[model samples]
Target: MAKRRTTPKELPDAVREAVDRTVQATRGSAVQTRERAQGAVDDLVDTVDDLVKGAEGRIVRGRRAAARAIDDVRPATNEDMRELKAELRRIGRRLEAIEERLPAKRPPTTRQGAKSGSGSAKPRAARSGSSAKPRSAKRGSSAG
Candidate 1:
Protein backbone atom coordinates (compact mmCIF):
# COMPACT_ATOMS: atom_id res chain seq x y z
CA MET A 1 0.00 0.00 0.00
CA ALA A 2 1.81 3.16 -1.26
CA LYS A 3 0.63 6.50 0.17
CA ARG A 4 -0.32 9.18 -2.40
CA ARG A 5 1.25 12.72 -2.20
CA THR A 6 -0.81 15.77 -3.13
CA THR A 7 0.62 18.23 -5.74
CA PRO A 8 0.25 22.03 -5.41
CA LYS A 9 -1.74 22.30 -8.64
CA GLU A 10 -4.20 19.71 -7.32
CA LEU A 11 -4.58 21.18 -3.72
CA PRO A 12 -8.12 21.37 -2.22
CA ASP A 13 -9.85 24.79 -2.16
CA ALA A 14 -10.24 24.74 1.70
CA VAL A 15 -6.50 24.04 2.13
CA ARG A 16 -5.56 26.90 -0.19
CA GLU A 17 -7.89 29.28 1.66
CA ALA A 18 -6.32 28.25 4.97
CA VAL A 19 -2.83 28.91 3.64
CA ASP A 20 -3.81 32.39 2.40
CA ARG A 21 -5.39 33.21 5.79
CA THR A 22 -2.18 32.14 7.60
CA VAL A 23 -0.05 34.34 5.36
CA GLN A 24 -2.31 37.35 5.92
CA ALA A 25 -2.28 36.78 9.67
CA THR A 26 1.51 36.58 9.66
CA ARG A 27 1.77 39.86 7.69
CA GLY A 28 -0.55 41.57 10.14
CA SER A 29 1.45 40.27 13.10
CA ALA A 30 4.71 41.46 11.51
CA VAL A 31 3.27 44.96 10.92
CA GLN A 32 2.12 45.14 14.56
CA THR A 33 5.57 44.04 15.76
CA ARG A 34 7.26 46.68 13.67
CA GLU A 35 4.95 49.42 14.98
CA ARG A 36 5.58 48.33 18.60
CA ALA A 37 9.37 48.28 18.03
CA GLN A 38 9.31 51.78 16.52
CA GLY A 39 7.29 53.06 19.44
CA ALA A 40 9.75 51.51 21.93
CA VAL A 41 12.66 53.14 20.14
CA ASP A 42 10.96 56.53 20.21
CA ASP A 43 10.31 56.20 23.95
CA LEU A 44 13.91 55.22 24.56
CA VAL A 45 15.16 58.23 22.60
CA ASP A 46 12.93 60.59 24.61
CA THR A 47 14.13 59.10 27.88
CA VAL A 48 17.76 59.47 26.85
CA ASP A 49 17.15 63.08 25.88
CA ASP A 50 15.66 63.80 29.29
CA LEU A 51 18.59 62.15 31.05
CA VAL A 52 21.11 64.13 29.04
CA LYS A 53 19.35 67.42 29.84
CA GLY A 54 19.31 66.57 33.53
CA ALA A 55 23.01 65.73 33.45
CA GLU A 56 23.82 69.00 31.72
CA GLY A 57 21.90 70.92 34.36
CA ARG A 58 23.76 69.17 37.14
CA ILE A 59 27.12 69.89 35.51
CA VAL A 60 26.30 73.56 35.23
CA ARG A 61 25.27 73.75 38.86
CA GLY A 62 28.42 71.95 39.95
CA ARG A 63 30.62 74.34 37.99
CA ARG A 64 28.88 77.33 39.57
CA ALA A 65 29.32 75.92 43.04
CA ALA A 66 32.99 75.25 42.40
CA ALA A 67 33.48 78.79 41.19
CA ARG A 68 31.83 80.21 44.29
CA ALA A 69 33.98 78.05 46.54
CA ILE A 70 37.11 79.18 44.78
CA ASP A 71 36.04 82.79 45.04
CA ASP A 72 35.54 82.42 48.79
CA VAL A 73 39.09 81.13 49.32
CA ARG A 74 40.82 83.55 46.95
CA PRO A 75 42.28 86.83 48.29
CA ALA A 76 40.90 89.01 45.52
CA THR A 77 39.70 88.84 41.92
CA ASN A 78 41.15 91.02 39.16
CA GLU A 79 37.97 93.11 39.24
CA ASP A 80 38.43 93.77 42.95
CA MET A 81 42.06 94.76 42.42
CA ARG A 82 41.06 97.16 39.69
CA GLU A 83 38.46 98.76 41.95
CA LEU A 84 41.02 99.17 44.75
CA LYS A 85 43.50 100.79 42.38
CA ALA A 86 40.83 103.18 41.14
CA GLU A 87 39.90 104.13 44.72
CA LEU A 88 43.55 104.75 45.59
CA ARG A 89 43.95 107.02 42.57
CA ARG A 90 40.83 108.94 43.59
CA ILE A 91 42.21 109.42 47.12
CA GLY A 92 45.55 110.58 45.75
CA ARG A 93 43.81 113.13 43.55
CA ARG A 94 41.77 114.38 46.49
CA LEU A 95 44.93 114.71 48.61
CA GLU A 96 46.61 116.70 45.88
CA ALA A 97 43.64 119.03 45.64
CA ILE A 98 43.67 119.57 49.41
CA GLU A 99 47.39 120.32 49.37
CA GLU A 100 46.86 122.90 46.61
CA ARG A 101 44.18 124.69 48.64
CA LEU A 102 46.23 124.89 51.86
CA PRO A 103 48.64 127.73 52.76
CA ALA A 104 52.38 127.18 52.14
CA LYS A 105 54.53 126.32 55.17
CA ARG A 106 57.35 128.79 56.01
CA PRO A 107 60.34 128.71 58.36
CA PRO A 108 59.93 130.38 61.75
CA THR A 109 61.37 133.92 62.29
CA THR A 110 62.68 135.78 65.39
CA ARG A 111 62.17 139.54 66.18
CA GLN A 112 65.81 140.20 65.17
CA GLY A 113 67.05 139.70 61.61
CA ALA A 114 68.32 136.20 60.74
CA LYS A 115 71.67 137.72 59.62
CA SER A 116 72.38 139.21 63.14
CA GLY A 117 75.68 137.91 64.58
CA SER A 118 75.37 135.11 67.16
CA GLY A 119 77.64 137.04 69.68
CA SER A 120 75.08 139.91 70.06
CA ALA A 121 72.28 137.56 71.25
CA LYS A 122 72.05 136.88 74.98
CA PRO A 123 71.37 133.37 76.25
CA ARG A 124 67.65 132.60 76.88
CA ALA A 125 68.26 131.82 80.58
CA ALA A 126 70.15 135.11 81.15
CA ARG A 127 67.42 137.18 79.38
CA SER A 128 64.65 135.60 81.45
CA GLY A 129 66.75 135.95 84.67
CA SER A 130 64.49 133.68 86.75
CA SER A 131 66.68 130.85 88.13
CA ALA A 132 63.83 128.37 88.70
CA LYS A 133 64.31 125.03 86.91
CA PRO A 134 61.85 124.08 84.12
CA ARG A 135 58.75 122.15 85.15
CA SER A 136 59.85 119.10 83.12
CA ALA A 137 63.34 119.07 84.80
CA LYS A 138 61.73 119.35 88.26
CA ARG A 139 59.39 116.47 87.49
CA GLY A 140 62.27 114.31 86.21
CA SER A 141 64.36 115.05 89.34
CA SER A 142 61.43 114.25 91.64
CA ALA A 143 60.68 110.96 89.81
CA GLY A 144 64.34 109.89 89.99
Candidate 2:
Protein backbone atom coordinates (compact mmCIF):
# COMPACT_ATOMS: atom_id res chain seq x y z
CA MET A 1 0.00 0.00 0.00
CA ALA A 2 1.14 3.55 -0.66
CA LYS A 3 2.20 5.60 2.33
CA ARG A 4 -0.41 8.10 3.49
CA ARG A 5 0.35 11.74 2.69
CA THR A 6 -0.26 14.37 5.33
CA THR A 7 -2.00 17.69 4.72
CA PRO A 8 0.09 20.88 4.63
CA LYS A 9 0.89 22.60 7.90
CA GLU A 10 -1.69 24.90 9.51
CA LEU A 11 -1.05 28.61 9.06
CA PRO A 12 0.94 30.15 11.89
CA ASP A 13 -0.71 32.97 13.91
CA ALA A 14 1.30 35.65 12.13
CA VAL A 15 0.48 34.22 8.69
CA ARG A 16 -3.21 34.05 9.65
CA GLU A 17 -3.05 37.71 10.67
CA ALA A 18 -1.31 38.52 7.38
CA VAL A 19 -4.06 36.69 5.52
CA ASP A 20 -6.72 38.64 7.42
CA ARG A 21 -4.91 41.90 6.71
CA THR A 22 -4.53 40.97 3.07
CA VAL A 23 -8.22 40.09 2.89
CA GLN A 24 -9.14 43.38 4.56
CA ALA A 25 -6.81 45.37 2.29
CA THR A 26 -8.29 43.83 -0.83
CA ARG A 27 -11.88 43.99 0.37
CA GLY A 28 -14.01 46.25 -1.91
CA SER A 29 -10.82 47.23 -3.76
CA ALA A 30 -10.12 46.93 -7.51
CA VAL A 31 -8.44 43.47 -7.09
CA GLN A 32 -9.90 40.10 -6.03
CA THR A 33 -9.35 38.99 -2.38
CA ARG A 34 -7.44 35.78 -3.14
CA GLU A 35 -5.27 37.44 -5.76
CA ARG A 36 -4.40 40.42 -3.60
CA ALA A 37 -3.95 38.19 -0.53
CA GLN A 38 -1.61 36.01 -2.54
CA GLY A 39 0.32 39.11 -3.52
CA ALA A 40 0.54 40.31 0.08
CA VAL A 41 1.56 36.86 1.33
CA ASP A 42 4.11 36.63 -1.45
CA ASP A 43 5.45 40.06 -0.54
CA LEU A 44 5.69 39.05 3.14
CA VAL A 45 7.46 35.81 2.20
CA ASP A 46 9.85 37.71 -0.08
CA THR A 47 10.59 40.23 2.66
CA VAL A 48 11.27 37.48 5.22
CA ASP A 49 13.41 35.56 2.71
CA ASP A 50 15.39 38.72 2.01
CA LEU A 51 15.90 39.22 5.76
CA VAL A 52 17.08 35.62 6.17
CA LYS A 53 19.38 35.90 3.13
CA GLY A 54 20.78 39.16 4.46
CA ALA A 55 21.45 37.57 7.85
CA GLU A 56 23.02 34.54 6.17
CA GLY A 57 25.24 36.80 4.09
CA ARG A 58 26.28 38.73 7.18
CA ILE A 59 27.04 35.44 8.98
CA VAL A 60 29.14 34.24 6.05
CA ARG A 61 31.06 37.51 6.00
CA GLY A 62 31.46 37.42 9.77
CA ARG A 63 32.75 33.83 9.65
CA ARG A 64 35.23 34.77 6.93
CA ALA A 65 36.37 37.81 8.92
CA ALA A 66 36.75 35.73 12.10
CA ALA A 67 38.59 32.97 10.21
CA ARG A 68 40.94 35.55 8.75
CA ALA A 69 41.50 37.05 12.21
CA ILE A 70 42.28 33.68 13.88
CA ASP A 71 44.26 32.12 11.02
CA ASP A 72 48.09 32.19 11.03
CA VAL A 73 49.66 33.47 7.85
CA ARG A 74 53.24 32.55 6.85
CA PRO A 75 55.51 35.51 7.47
CA ALA A 76 58.75 36.27 5.53
CA THR A 77 61.12 35.00 8.25
CA ASN A 78 61.37 32.76 11.35
CA GLU A 79 61.93 35.98 13.40
CA ASP A 80 58.36 37.02 12.59
CA MET A 81 57.19 33.66 13.93
CA ARG A 82 58.62 34.60 17.34
CA GLU A 83 56.73 37.89 17.34
CA LEU A 84 53.56 36.06 16.24
CA LYS A 85 53.98 33.52 19.08
CA ALA A 86 54.45 36.31 21.62
CA GLU A 87 51.40 38.10 20.34
CA LEU A 88 49.42 34.86 20.48
CA ARG A 89 50.61 34.30 24.05
CA ARG A 90 49.54 37.82 25.02
CA ILE A 91 46.11 37.19 23.42
CA GLY A 92 45.84 33.92 25.35
CA ARG A 93 46.48 35.63 28.73
CA ARG A 94 43.99 38.33 27.90
CA LEU A 95 41.35 35.77 26.94
CA GLU A 96 42.05 33.79 30.08
CA ALA A 97 41.61 36.87 32.25
CA ILE A 98 38.37 37.70 30.47
CA GLU A 99 37.03 34.21 30.96
CA GLU A 100 37.99 34.25 34.61
CA ARG A 101 36.04 37.43 35.15
CA LEU A 102 33.02 36.32 33.09
CA PRO A 103 30.26 33.99 34.21
CA ALA A 104 30.70 30.25 33.66
CA LYS A 105 28.81 29.26 30.54
CA ARG A 106 26.03 26.71 30.89
CA PRO A 107 24.35 24.53 28.31
CA PRO A 108 21.05 25.92 27.03
CA THR A 109 17.89 23.99 27.77
CA THR A 110 14.32 24.70 26.66
CA ARG A 111 11.97 24.51 29.63
CA GLN A 112 10.03 21.63 28.07
CA GLY A 113 13.24 19.73 27.32
CA ALA A 114 14.39 20.19 30.89
CA LYS A 115 11.01 19.11 32.20
CA SER A 116 11.12 15.99 30.04
CA GLY A 117 14.43 15.04 31.74
CA SER A 118 15.46 12.92 28.81
CA GLY A 119 19.15 13.69 29.06
CA SER A 120 20.19 11.62 26.05
CA ALA A 121 17.59 13.22 23.76
CA LYS A 122 18.26 16.83 24.71
CA PRO A 123 19.72 19.49 22.36
CA ARG A 124 22.49 20.19 24.85
CA ALA A 125 23.40 16.50 24.65
CA ALA A 126 24.13 16.89 20.93
CA ARG A 127 26.32 19.93 21.64
CA SER A 128 28.27 18.18 24.43
CA GLY A 129 31.09 16.96 22.15
CA SER A 130 30.73 19.75 19.61
CA SER A 131 33.60 22.15 18.87
CA ALA A 132 32.49 25.21 20.87
CA LYS A 133 35.83 25.78 22.56
CA PRO A 134 37.96 28.90 22.50
CA ARG A 135 40.55 28.63 19.66
CA SER A 136 43.55 28.52 21.97
CA ALA A 137 42.07 25.69 24.06
CA LYS A 138 44.09 22.45 24.13
CA ARG A 139 42.99 19.39 22.13
CA GLY A 140 42.74 17.48 25.42
CA SER A 141 39.67 19.58 26.26
CA SER A 142 37.68 17.85 23.49
CA ALA A 143 35.08 15.51 24.97
CA GLY A 144 35.81 12.90 22.34
Candidate 3:
Protein backbone atom coordinates (compact mmCIF):
# COMPACT_ATOMS: atom_id res chain seq x y z
CA MET A 1 0.00 0.00 0.00
CA ALA A 2 3.05 2.39 0.05
CA LYS A 3 4.23 3.40 -3.38
CA ARG A 4 6.17 6.59 -2.84
CA ARG A 5 7.44 8.71 -5.72
CA THR A 6 11.08 9.88 -5.22
CA THR A 7 12.86 12.69 -7.06
CA PRO A 8 15.73 11.48 -9.42
CA LYS A 9 19.21 12.91 -8.78
CA GLU A 10 20.89 14.13 -11.92
CA LEU A 11 24.23 12.54 -12.94
CA PRO A 12 26.85 14.64 -14.82
CA ASP A 13 28.12 13.46 -18.23
CA ALA A 14 31.78 14.10 -17.22
CA VAL A 15 31.38 11.87 -14.15
CA ARG A 16 29.88 9.13 -16.32
CA GLU A 17 32.80 9.33 -18.73
CA ALA A 18 35.29 9.14 -15.83
CA VAL A 19 33.60 6.00 -14.50
CA ASP A 20 33.80 4.40 -18.00
CA ARG A 21 37.50 5.19 -18.22
CA THR A 22 38.09 3.59 -14.84
CA VAL A 23 36.34 0.41 -15.97
CA GLN A 24 38.46 0.31 -19.15
CA ALA A 25 41.63 0.70 -17.12
CA THR A 26 40.50 -2.11 -14.86
CA ARG A 27 39.99 -4.39 -17.90
CA GLY A 28 43.48 -3.61 -19.16
CA SER A 29 44.90 -4.43 -15.70
CA ALA A 30 43.08 -7.77 -15.78
CA VAL A 31 44.75 -8.62 -19.07
CA GLN A 32 48.14 -7.73 -17.67
CA THR A 33 47.48 -9.91 -14.62
CA ARG A 34 46.64 -12.83 -16.88
CA GLU A 35 49.84 -12.31 -18.86
CA ARG A 36 51.86 -12.16 -15.63
CA ALA A 37 50.27 -15.38 -14.43
CA GLN A 38 51.16 -17.09 -17.70
CA GLY A 39 54.74 -15.88 -17.46
CA ALA A 40 54.97 -17.24 -13.89
CA VAL A 41 53.66 -20.58 -15.08
CA ASP A 42 56.29 -20.72 -17.80
CA ASP A 43 59.05 -19.95 -15.30
CA LEU A 44 57.75 -22.65 -12.98
CA VAL A 45 57.78 -25.20 -15.84
CA ASP A 46 61.34 -24.29 -16.68
CA THR A 47 62.35 -24.75 -13.02
CA VAL A 48 60.69 -28.14 -12.90
CA ASP A 49 62.45 -29.22 -16.08
CA ASP A 50 65.81 -28.17 -14.67
CA LEU A 51 65.10 -30.02 -11.45
CA VAL A 52 64.32 -33.21 -13.36
CA LYS A 53 67.47 -32.95 -15.42
CA GLY A 54 69.60 -32.32 -12.33
CA ALA A 55 68.04 -35.27 -10.55
CA GLU A 56 68.79 -37.49 -13.52
CA GLY A 57 72.40 -36.44 -13.46
CA ARG A 58 72.60 -37.18 -9.75
CA ILE A 59 71.10 -40.59 -10.28
CA VAL A 60 73.66 -41.34 -12.93
CA ARG A 61 76.44 -40.26 -10.60
CA GLY A 62 75.03 -42.41 -7.81
CA ARG A 63 74.92 -45.45 -10.04
CA ARG A 64 78.50 -44.89 -11.08
CA ALA A 65 79.55 -44.57 -7.45
CA ALA A 66 77.84 -47.83 -6.59
CA ALA A 67 79.56 -49.59 -9.45
CA ARG A 68 82.93 -48.17 -8.44
CA ALA A 69 82.41 -49.29 -4.85
CA ILE A 70 81.68 -52.82 -5.97
CA ASP A 71 84.73 -52.86 -8.16
CA ASP A 72 86.88 -51.49 -5.33
CA VAL A 73 85.89 -54.29 -3.00
CA ARG A 74 86.17 -57.10 -5.56
CA PRO A 75 89.91 -57.56 -5.39
CA ALA A 76 90.03 -57.39 -1.61
CA THR A 77 87.15 -59.77 -1.29
CA ASN A 78 88.78 -62.22 -3.66
CA GLU A 79 92.08 -61.93 -1.84
CA ASP A 80 90.43 -62.53 1.48
CA MET A 81 88.77 -65.65 0.18
CA ARG A 82 92.03 -66.87 -1.28
CA GLU A 83 93.87 -66.21 1.96
CA LEU A 84 91.20 -68.05 3.90
CA LYS A 85 91.49 -71.06 1.60
CA ALA A 86 95.26 -71.01 1.88
CA GLU A 87 95.11 -70.84 5.65
CA LEU A 88 92.72 -73.77 5.72
CA ARG A 89 95.07 -75.81 3.55
CA ARG A 90 98.02 -74.92 5.77
CA ILE A 91 96.13 -76.01 8.87
CA GLY A 92 95.18 -79.31 7.21
CA ARG A 93 98.78 -79.98 6.25
CA ARG A 94 100.01 -79.20 9.74
CA LEU A 95 97.47 -81.61 11.17
CA GLU A 96 98.62 -84.33 8.77
CA ALA A 97 102.27 -83.75 9.68
CA ILE A 98 101.44 -83.94 13.38
CA GLU A 99 99.63 -87.23 12.83
CA GLU A 100 102.55 -88.66 10.84
CA ARG A 101 105.02 -87.94 13.71
CA LEU A 102 102.91 -89.74 16.28
CA PRO A 103 104.35 -92.91 17.84
CA ALA A 104 103.17 -96.30 16.52
CA LYS A 105 101.05 -98.53 18.71
CA ARG A 106 102.58 -101.92 19.62
CA PRO A 107 100.69 -105.19 20.13
CA PRO A 108 100.41 -106.74 23.60
CA THR A 109 103.25 -109.14 24.73
CA THR A 110 102.61 -112.92 24.66
CA ARG A 111 103.31 -115.31 27.53
CA GLN A 112 105.93 -117.96 26.57
CA GLY A 113 105.18 -120.10 29.61
CA ALA A 114 101.50 -120.33 28.81
CA LYS A 115 102.15 -122.01 25.42
CA SER A 116 102.82 -125.72 25.84
CA GLY A 117 102.06 -126.73 22.26
CA SER A 118 104.76 -127.49 19.69
CA GLY A 119 103.28 -125.18 17.08
CA SER A 120 104.20 -122.07 19.07
CA ALA A 121 106.37 -119.32 17.55
CA LYS A 122 109.57 -117.93 19.19
CA PRO A 123 109.67 -114.53 20.84
CA ARG A 124 112.13 -111.94 19.40
CA ALA A 125 113.60 -109.03 21.41
CA ALA A 126 113.35 -105.37 20.31
CA ARG A 127 116.75 -104.00 19.19
CA SER A 128 118.02 -100.65 17.92
CA GLY A 129 121.05 -101.57 15.69
CA SER A 130 121.40 -104.46 13.28
CA SER A 131 122.11 -107.92 14.70
CA ALA A 132 125.50 -109.80 14.27
CA LYS A 133 123.71 -112.03 11.73
CA PRO A 134 123.68 -110.97 8.11
CA ARG A 135 120.57 -109.25 6.61
CA SER A 136 119.67 -112.39 4.52
CA ALA A 137 120.46 -114.88 7.36
CA LYS A 138 118.88 -112.62 9.98
CA ARG A 139 115.32 -113.55 9.02
CA GLY A 140 116.24 -117.18 7.90
CA SER A 141 117.63 -117.28 4.34
CA SER A 142 121.39 -117.68 3.50
CA ALA A 143 121.38 -115.14 0.63
CA GLY A 144 123.65 -112.68 2.51
Candidate 4:
Protein backbone atom coordinates (compact mmCIF):
# COMPACT_ATOMS: atom_id res chain seq x y z
CA MET A 1 0.00 0.00 0.00
CA ALA A 2 1.11 3.58 -0.82
CA LYS A 3 1.58 5.86 2.21
CA ARG A 4 -0.63 8.99 2.17
CA ARG A 5 1.53 12.12 2.60
CA THR A 6 0.07 14.85 4.86
CA THR A 7 1.79 17.61 6.83
CA PRO A 8 1.14 18.00 10.59
CA LYS A 9 0.76 21.74 10.06
CA GLU A 10 -2.15 21.21 7.55
CA LEU A 11 -4.02 18.72 9.80
CA PRO A 12 -6.82 20.11 12.09
CA ASP A 13 -6.00 20.41 15.82
CA ALA A 14 -8.86 18.04 16.84
CA VAL A 15 -7.82 15.39 14.30
CA ARG A 16 -4.19 15.53 15.51
CA GLU A 17 -5.25 15.24 19.13
CA ALA A 18 -7.53 12.27 18.30
CA VAL A 19 -4.65 10.48 16.49
CA ASP A 20 -2.33 11.07 19.47
CA ARG A 21 -4.89 9.68 21.89
CA THR A 22 -5.33 6.54 19.72
CA VAL A 23 -1.55 6.01 19.62
CA GLN A 24 -1.30 6.38 23.40
CA ALA A 25 -4.17 3.96 23.93
CA THR A 26 -2.56 1.37 21.62
CA ARG A 27 0.76 1.65 23.46
CA GLY A 28 -0.98 1.21 26.86
CA SER A 29 -2.89 -1.85 25.63
CA ALA A 30 0.41 -3.47 24.41
CA VAL A 31 2.03 -2.90 27.80
CA GLN A 32 -0.95 -4.36 29.65
CA THR A 33 -0.99 -7.42 27.35
CA ARG A 34 2.73 -8.07 27.95
CA GLU A 35 2.31 -7.82 31.72
CA ARG A 36 -0.69 -10.16 31.71
CA ALA A 37 1.17 -12.72 29.56
CA GLN A 38 4.19 -12.62 31.93
CA GLY A 39 1.91 -13.09 34.94
CA ALA A 40 0.28 -16.13 33.27
CA VAL A 41 3.72 -17.65 32.61
CA ASP A 42 4.75 -17.18 36.24
CA ASP A 43 1.52 -18.78 37.49
CA LEU A 44 1.99 -21.74 35.15
CA VAL A 45 5.57 -22.26 36.41
CA ASP A 46 4.43 -22.18 40.03
CA THR A 47 1.64 -24.70 39.34
CA VAL A 48 4.09 -27.10 37.67
CA ASP A 49 6.48 -26.79 40.59
CA ASP A 50 3.69 -27.58 43.06
CA LEU A 51 2.65 -30.59 40.98
CA VAL A 52 6.21 -31.92 41.00
CA LYS A 53 6.47 -31.55 44.77
CA GLY A 54 3.15 -33.38 45.23
CA ALA A 55 4.33 -36.22 43.04
CA GLU A 56 7.61 -36.47 44.96
CA GLY A 57 5.71 -36.57 48.23
CA ARG A 58 3.50 -39.38 46.91
CA ILE A 59 6.55 -41.33 45.75
CA VAL A 60 8.16 -41.04 49.17
CA ARG A 61 4.95 -42.15 50.87
CA GLY A 62 4.67 -45.11 48.50
CA ARG A 63 8.23 -46.20 49.29
CA ARG A 64 7.53 -46.00 53.01
CA ALA A 65 4.33 -48.00 52.58
CA ALA A 66 6.19 -50.66 50.62
CA ALA A 67 8.85 -50.89 53.32
CA ARG A 68 6.19 -51.32 55.99
CA ALA A 69 4.52 -54.06 53.99
CA ILE A 70 7.84 -55.92 53.64
CA ASP A 71 8.46 -55.65 57.36
CA ASP A 72 5.01 -57.08 58.10
CA VAL A 73 5.65 -60.19 56.00
CA ARG A 74 9.35 -60.69 56.87
CA PRO A 75 10.32 -64.16 58.03
CA ALA A 76 10.64 -64.74 61.79
CA THR A 77 14.17 -64.94 63.21
CA ASN A 78 15.57 -68.16 64.62
CA GLU A 79 15.07 -66.94 68.17
CA ASP A 80 11.42 -66.16 67.49
CA MET A 81 10.85 -69.58 65.97
CA ARG A 82 12.50 -71.25 68.93
CA GLU A 83 10.34 -69.37 71.36
CA LEU A 84 7.19 -70.34 69.44
CA LYS A 85 8.19 -74.01 69.47
CA ALA A 86 8.86 -73.88 73.20
CA GLU A 87 5.45 -72.35 73.84
CA LEU A 88 3.76 -75.10 71.79
CA ARG A 89 5.62 -77.81 73.71
CA ARG A 90 4.57 -76.22 77.01
CA ILE A 91 0.93 -76.18 75.90
CA GLY A 92 1.13 -79.83 74.80
CA ARG A 93 2.54 -80.87 78.19
CA ARG A 94 -0.29 -79.08 80.03
CA LEU A 95 -2.90 -80.80 77.82
CA GLU A 96 -1.33 -84.22 78.45
CA ALA A 97 -1.35 -83.66 82.22
CA ILE A 98 -5.04 -82.78 82.11
CA GLU A 99 -5.82 -85.90 80.07
CA GLU A 100 -3.92 -88.16 82.49
CA ARG A 101 -6.19 -87.07 85.39
CA LEU A 102 -9.38 -88.16 83.51
CA PRO A 103 -10.82 -91.68 84.18
CA ALA A 104 -10.37 -94.47 81.57
CA LYS A 105 -13.31 -95.44 79.34
CA ARG A 106 -14.94 -98.83 80.06
CA PRO A 107 -15.39 -101.48 77.28
CA PRO A 108 -18.99 -102.40 76.21
CA THR A 109 -20.45 -105.48 78.03
CA THR A 110 -21.66 -108.66 76.20
CA ARG A 111 -24.23 -111.39 77.11
CA GLN A 112 -23.35 -113.45 80.24
CA GLY A 113 -23.39 -116.73 78.26
CA ALA A 114 -21.03 -115.37 75.57
CA LYS A 115 -18.26 -117.91 74.95
CA SER A 116 -14.91 -116.62 76.10
CA GLY A 117 -13.08 -119.33 74.08
CA SER A 118 -14.72 -118.07 70.86
CA GLY A 119 -12.36 -115.02 70.96
CA SER A 120 -14.78 -113.01 68.72
CA ALA A 121 -15.21 -109.38 69.93
CA LYS A 122 -18.84 -108.87 68.74
CA PRO A 123 -21.65 -108.81 71.40
CA ARG A 124 -24.66 -111.22 71.04
CA ALA A 125 -28.34 -110.20 71.70
CA ALA A 126 -30.02 -112.20 74.50
CA ARG A 127 -33.38 -113.96 74.05
CA SER A 128 -36.64 -112.19 75.13
CA GLY A 129 -36.89 -114.22 78.45
CA SER A 130 -33.56 -115.89 78.90
CA SER A 131 -31.61 -116.58 82.07
CA ALA A 132 -29.32 -113.66 80.99
CA LYS A 133 -30.26 -110.30 82.46
CA PRO A 134 -32.26 -107.81 80.38
CA ARG A 135 -30.28 -105.05 78.53
CA SER A 136 -31.83 -102.21 80.62
CA ALA A 137 -31.02 -104.07 83.89
CA LYS A 138 -27.36 -104.67 82.95
CA ARG A 139 -26.92 -101.16 81.50
CA GLY A 140 -28.00 -98.31 83.83
CA SER A 141 -31.40 -96.96 82.66
CA SER A 142 -33.42 -96.48 79.42
CA ALA A 143 -34.35 -93.09 77.90
CA GLY A 144 -38.00 -94.14 77.23
Q: Top lDDT: which candidate number?
A: 1
Cα lDDT tens digits for candidate 4, 45-89: 999999999999999999999999998999999998999999997
**Roughly what TM-score does model 1 have, to 2 decimal places?**
0.52
Q: Give RMSD to native, each candidate.
A: 17.8, 33.1, 17.1, 15.6
lDDT of 3 by residue, 33-123 (tens): 9999999999999999999999999999999999999988876677889999999979967876887798975875667786656433543
Question: Judged by TM-score, which candidate is best?
Answer: 1
lDDT of 1 by residue, 73-132 (tens): 989879999999999979967876887799986754576666656554666666888797
Return the TM-score for each candidate structure. Answer: 0.52, 0.30, 0.41, 0.42
lDDT score for residue 126 of model 4: 43
Clashes of each: 0, 0, 0, 0
Task: Give the backbone clash total of model 2.
Answer: 0
Tens-digit lDDT track for model 2 on 9-120?
A: 6657678899999887877474576778999999999999999999999999999988887665634477878889989989977987887899977876567546565556
**How does candidate 3 score on lDDT?**
0.78
Error of 4 at 131 (Å): 52
Off by over 4 Å in 4: 1-9, 12-18, 76-144
Q: Higher TM-score: candidate 1 or 2?
A: 1
